[model samples]
Target: MTSLALGPATPAATPRAATPPHAATPSGAAVPVTPAAAATRRPSEGSVHSWDLSTGVDGPGTRFVTFLSGCPLTCLYCHNPDTWRMRNGRRTSAASVIAEAGKYVRFISASGGGATVSGGEPLLQPVFTGELLHRMKHELGLHTALDTSGFLGVRATDALLRDTDLVLLDIKSWDPDTYEKVTGRPLRPTLDFARRLADLGQEVHVRFVLVPGLTDDPADVEGVAAFAGGLGNVSRVDILPFHKLGEAKWQALAMPFALHDTPSPTPERIAEVREVFRAHGLNAV
Candidate 1:
């Protein structure tokens, strides 16, 4: 994810009750609240890594992007390694996140941008993610975008999709084995999500990180391009060149930087990849 301003973590808030309040039964006995009823009363909370302001790269104009914590896939080129664990993030409520974004509402709208709920993987906390999207769209009246790998796409409810104006879907790789090699997870879920988005006519920007020797194969790139093009809902394809910007973070976390020696794709290579997407009749940037 591209960011201009990296804000400090939001202060942790008081925790909620573990059990719901009991209801009085018709026989004058206290009855435990039903699971469904308790859910409605529970506040939306999630593990937040951090937030930042970015332009052009994240989505549309300038955006207030929230980076939620926890992800299923362990991508070789993940820049935010610190966000891999949910426990590493600060516990905060959805209202607090909205309040933070509300501070930049006018500025974001003026730039033709909106709010993006990104992650470690936003879908890791579907209820909280949905709350952020719904309030950001309905309350703030801003365009909403979800930046995700689509691995947990099944968790996103239709209500959440309805509130989302754009989706920055990262289709890391196309070939099943290659995808697994790049993300340490299967590719079926993401492809399934893409098809679902197409069926819903959802607007999407397919993001692909071009890494030399890893995902630079012409056949693999072609597969992604063809799939995104066939979706009919993908408005643009973003061919991002791999970089070692997160190398320092990995070292700080005491984790192996597997791609430490991997060189960024050359400008020529990047242009070639873009041309592949263009051949599919989709806009590439």
Candidate 2:
């Protein structure tokens, strides 16, 4: 679910969540809860692209995956380019989102799972994302995970991470030049955010997409593995093999398919990469 945006034609069926009484305004203003602000800051809505009641992939067990719209990065391998636009999604309230997750909380919790908010970078909508996670943890007592590219990690607040149980962080590349080439964004911000997450004792699962030539350089892989290992808080490293699944998405969107003809890595290649991570004493899969 990393590169080449999957502009799925699932129809705008998912609902978004809204603001909390104590939260700041959407413009980052500190406003008291007034009738006007309440209506404007309505806790009943968020910009949600789609959702899925998933298992295994999104998080630990059964999960309520809410994919929000809007992202800053234009990764060459983006799978959800459809999510690249901001607020181009259905608006639902916080209550509505929680309600949907509530329907599966029992099954999720029973299997040591919970809800994960992903998107074109969830941090782009920090207020909505934070509020939703807070409720998921405090109100429903469900484990919460955030799947993000970390490009907008600076927008994340302390309160938000407190509610997050785990982070599915996608580290696109190691070298600054290559990172920028892979994603139309810099790498330091992501590294800074990863460091911050580690400093907070938050659990993190490092997700790396292994592109055939772009990111297969041994130096790049070693750099990432070493850096991740030093963090101490990284629980797992998932070396995802590159695929053409999202090529159709790119073509459908009329976006250039740079890696259109790229082949997926073989099992041995993936294992070799996994071994690189393991060499750093990391748990790789």
- CA lDDT of every candidate: 0.86, 0.81
The local lDDT score (0 to 100) that residue 261 gets in candidate 1 is 83
- Highest-TM-score candidate: 1
Q: Name the 10 consecutive residues with the lowest summed lDDT in model 1.
A: 17-26
**RMSD, every candidate, angstroms:** 6.2, 4.1
Residue 117 displacement in candidate 1 (angstroms): 0.3
TM-score of each model, in listed order = 0.90, 0.87
**Candidate whose lDDT is highest:** 1
> Over the stretch 133-233, how does candidate 1's per-residue lDDT look in tens digits?
88888889999999999998887776678889999999999889989998999999999989999999999999999999989999999999999999999
The residue-by-residue lDDT of candidate 2 on 1-285, one tens digit each, is 222232322333444344554454455443445657667653445678877777655778777788888899999888778888875676656676777678777877898878899998888888788878988888899989999988777777776787899999999899999999999889999999899999999999999999988998899999999999999999999998987776787888888989887888888889999999999999998
lDDT at residue 266 of model 1 (Cα atoms): 94
